[model samples]
Target: MPRSIWKGAISFGLVTIPVKLYSATEEKDIAFRQVHASDGGRIKYRRVCEIDGEEIPFPEIAKGYELADGRMVILEKEDFDNLPLATTKAVEVVQFVAEDEVDPTYFNKTYFMQADGPGTKPYVLLRDALVKTGQCALVKVALRSREALALVRPRDGLLVMHTMLWPDELRSGEFAAPPETVSVSDAEVTMAQSFIEALSGDFKPEEYTDAYREALEEVVQSKASGVAMPEQTEAPKEAEVVDLVAALRASVEAAKKRRAEGSAAATG
Candidate 1:
């Protein structure tokens, strides 16, 4: 099992479930390190003072908040510790709302809320309750040195906590003008519905593969073996101007063809 990033309790209406938070996702992208190109040496960065042009140690650094008139309010570690918000260690549930009411765009990172020792009963109860009622718990959690608003919801059979974006941070529809509705013929609407039906399939996430990762691995392997790298091919160019209605009709026909072929292959 992966190491737990945080150990905490989920609090709701006098009930607290001890849970270990584990990251739900992992980044597998190829990473490149900063290095000196000529000598192949690793590049290093230093914290230097803008005024004095001197390198400063980590211990000498203090947090600062910029003001309106180019002035800074420097703060020591003790200053933050004395703040009222810092004293709270518990994950406080503020409210429960319908899970569907929450917009997905507001969701940031996700963490698995695994039951800690003797927490299985309450954890399962909360999970079942959420599944049955279709409600999500809006909670406030202090993690990574900052207070975060989160949504605790059921995913599969486990509880997942997703950090929510602040209301002010979300863009409102008032920024853009509303779109005009266009009327479509019955024949076109029927064809579009048929296309959607043709394209429908089970959402098996495992079926998806990262072609870029595979290509990168192949390139790295070839270079490590001292083999000459193949020349990269340019992607085919698309038409600069496209007819929306024609494209939709063509896509529908393509989907229908794919579905027919799949059905035929299944029978054969």
Candidate 2:
């Protein structure tokens, strides 16, 4: 089992449900180490004090905040523990909102909340309530050294928490919007929507694979085994469409053809 990253209780009204938080997702990107290009000798680094010129160990390290006046303020673990925040040790429920009401752009990281000892019954109660009510709880909690706005919702019979961004953290997207001057004909809009319909299907996440990661893994394996690297395939080029309506019609036909091929392969 994966180790829990955080241990706290969900503050649901007057009830407390003790839970352990575990990261709900991971990246599969291949990792590489810094090395000498000539002979592949691994590169190493050391943390040394500027004044003493002595290498410092990890345990000896402490966070330092630099001031504009060229002064440093050192902080200890005890300092953070004494900070004024109720969320440091517990997840606090603030309010409930329809899940769709919260913009997905505010979401940051997700975690699975497993019930701790003696809290299983209450955890099940909260999870079931959320599932039945069709609403998610807006929450606040401190994790990874800071208090964060978060959401707790039930997913597949378990309580899931997602950290959210502050409202000010989001950038204005007005610049990306299409200008009012750029107008489209009704026919073009209909045909573009037709292309969308042709390509649409149930969103099966399992059907997609990261081809670039797979190719990168192959390259790494080849380098390790003294074999030739995998040959790269040329990307498909889009056909030039000078007319807007013709482009939309061609796209609809191409999308339909691809969908037909996919269906045939699935059935066969």
Candidate 3:
């Protein structure tokens, strides 16, 4: 089992449920190390002081806040721990709202809450209640030296918390005005609706994959084994549509044909 990152309690009204927070997701991104192109040697960096031009050890490095006037304010670990922030390690549910009311844009990192011994009953109660009501609890939690707004919801018989981005952190998306001059005809809209209906199906996340990552993994394995890498063929580009209505009609027909072929292959 993976180790828990945080130990806290969920303050639900009069009850407090002790829980441990575990990261709900993990990144599978391919990472590369910096290396010299000619000799293939790993690159190394040293932290040097700007004023003294001397390499500084990790222990001697201190957090500094530089002022606009070229002055620096250094802070220690003790100073951070004594800061005037509510450092109480608890997830306080402030309000409950319909699950749809929470905009997905505000969501950041997600963590799974596991009941910490003695609090299992209360934790199950909250999870069941959320599942029945289909509501999410808006909460405040302190993690990583800062307080954050979070949403708690039930998922697979467990309470999951998603930290939210502050409203001010979200940028206004007013880059350009909507194209009012462009309009769609009823026939074009109907054909487009047909295309959508033909292509629509239940979303199964397992069916999709990162093809690029798989190809990169194959390349790495082949190179290690002294085998030739597989050749890749470029996909043919679609011809530009001169007529909007014609394109919509063609799309609907293509969707229907693909669906019919898929059904035939499945039955076969």
lDDT of 3 by residue, 1-268 (tens): 9999999799999998999999999988778889999998999999999899999999999899999998999999887767775535689999999878988999999999999998999999999999888898999988876788999999877889999999999988777666879887888888888888889999989979999988888888998899998677889999988887889888888888988998899899
Q: Mind giving the per-residue lDDT tens digits that candidate 2 earns over 1-268?
A: 9999999899999999999999999998888899999999999999999999999999999999999999999999999988898999899999999999999999999999999999999999999998889999999999988889999999988999999999999999999999999998998899889988888889989999999998888888898899997566999997777788899898899888888898899999
State residue 5's C-alpha deviation in candidate 2, in Å. 1.0
The number of the candidate with the highest TM-score is: 2
For model 3, what is the error of residue 15's alpha carbon versus the real structure, in angstroms, after optimal superposition? 1.2
**Model 1: lDDT of residue 28:** 95
What overall lDDT goes with each candidate model? 0.85, 0.93, 0.89
Ranking by lDDT: 2, 3, 1
lDDT, candidate 1, 1-268, per-residue tens: 9999888788877998888899999999999889999997999999999999999999999999999999999989887656677214567889999988888988989999999998899999999998999899999987776778899999989999998878888887775765568566776677677778778989978968999999999999998999978888999997653555566678888988887897899899
Error of 1 at 142 (Å): 2.0
For candidate 2, the per-residue lDDT at 233 reads: 90
Which residues of candidate 3, in runs, are more than 4 Å off? none
TM-score of each: 0.80, 0.93, 0.91
Cα error, residue 105 of model 1, in Å, equals 0.4
Residue 126 of candidate 1: its Cα lDDT? 91
